[model samples]
Target: MDILDILLSASFWAAAIRIASPLIFATLGELICERAGVLNLGIEGIMVAGAFSGWIAVWAGLPLWGGVAVAMLTGMAFGLLHATLSVPFGLSQHVVGIGLTLLATSLTFYTYRVVLPEVSSPPKIEAFQPYEIPLLADLPLIGPALFSQTPLTYAAFLLAAICAYTLYRTPVGLAVRAAGENPSAVAAQGLSVTAIRMGAVITGSGFMAVGGAFLTLSAFDSFFFDMVNGRGWICIALVVFGAWRPGKAVLGAILFAAFDALQIRLQQTAIGALVPYQLFLMLPYILSILALVVMSRRAEVPAALMVPFNKGER
Candidate 1:
């Protein structure tokens, strides 16, 4: 089919939504961290660890949801380390985040070797299947594209909505945002800046891990090396593209997913015969970079982002 026909197809949209699911989770996690004025660059490694943790847990006989919980806990453990170094200690966030990424990634790889030294290929598990919402799945293009997704996809959307509401409509959210925008104000109000920032990082990292878990538990049945494939970094950019708002960030994820889905389809079309395959691979990232540039030009960053706060000193 041609590009137009492909774009109009229900299956194409369904694929787009499916592809966007993991990104939505990770982007939201990154958004939460940035909103709290911390940048958790460890997301890439955390995702890798999460993917393995969840899959291994399932392989070891945990229920599907149990695997998810294990992944979140694993991510939170890393988040705790990130927070300990960057928040109260007031170290260089960039350095700490990158270091955490290396540590987590290496540790995960070592554990994988230790657990299955003789295995040539990663083992497979029963991944999540698509769950079609009754009447909603019966509708036109929108139905299958939006309603017929794995449970994790639904959770991603739900989490986005909850994040938006919490950031804009709740008192606790106010404190979190205040901690990012003005830590002194948060401290003045008797809320601990260190506590708020550390909490945000820890919680956000859990969500990031769940994002990784989605890859293993929903998108694919088996885990392998480089499965995450820099999606973590993409989610970071998506957070900036969405201006750190959950709803907008979700839209950004879908947009990128659409680009990705389009490129895959394009590679199978008549035009695919004449072009280099690498171009097809680059299409989504090129489009995303252009979009990011346009969106970020107008995006407002949190005033206190990446700025360490030492209580009683300022």
Candidate 2:
């Protein structure tokens, strides 16, 4: 009946985790790209491409896991295209990112239409169901919400830990940071700046694809136009708010998803009768923008971000 009732509901938290799953994937992918200083604005297109390709693969008789793989590969291919243009060829990062976004988005829509009937009813696939951990799922307030989830949800958390460890505890991570902040210095140290950057792009793009696949394969079972619904853009914004850290990004994703879940529930409740529910829907984005403005100056962006690394010159 009130804000406390909404916040304390276990079902509400459960819904939030479910909604945040795909966002966790997308935000991590964006964090990786930005950490590498690539500014891969093609993130939205990549998510769309993965969602469509993964759905098509499922419809074509591949296993659900296989569909996820297909989505990642599709995203990786786009990542390579982006890396080739911006990393090795020294194209403008902004131009390359936008071009790739347009290319990927157009190609995905066109191919889907060409292959399948572009009718009103979109095709559907079997979606992943929740797997409740025995003891953990039975816990008081947090149990059902945090413990019972699809494998993809669990994987998102695992990924957050893996990314944190990789970025902060490994030599490869240092090189990744160096490539983004000072590629010239990295090149001077005899490391191939191109290779490091390309690796980041490919890996980051794969994560983006996984995010998209989560939508089609786990969150929802059907594929349609605009299924991504600007979550990719939200992920980009969250990266800035998260300060480019994987753990912080995960926190940001979960927070945004909480608002998202709340807004959906609020719209369906009697609360909508008393107030404009659409305002609730804007909570996550509005919060993100405010967080960015308030914290952007304090955020530590890569020093050489968006600047092409010309090895022979400066």
Error of 2 at 39 (Å): 0.4
For model 1, what is the alpha-carbon lDDT of residue 141?
95
Number of colliding residue pairs in each model: 0, 0
Give the alpha-carbon lDDT of every model: 0.93, 0.87
| Candidate 1 lDDT over residue span 109-178, tens digit each | 9999999899868999999999999999999998999999999999999999999999899987898899
Which stretches in model 1 have alpha-carbon errors above 4 Å? none
Best by lDDT: 1
Mind giving the per-residue lDDT tens digits that candidate 2 earns over 1-314?
56678889998999999988988887888788778778888888999999989989998999988998999999999999988998889899888887887898899989988988556787788888899989999999899899989988999999999999998899898888888898888998999998999889888988898899899999999887788988888888888888888888888888888887777777767777888867987877887777678767788999878888878985
Highest-TM-score candidate:
1
- Stretch of 10 with least lDDT, candidate 2: 288-297
What pairs collide in candidate 2? Answer: none
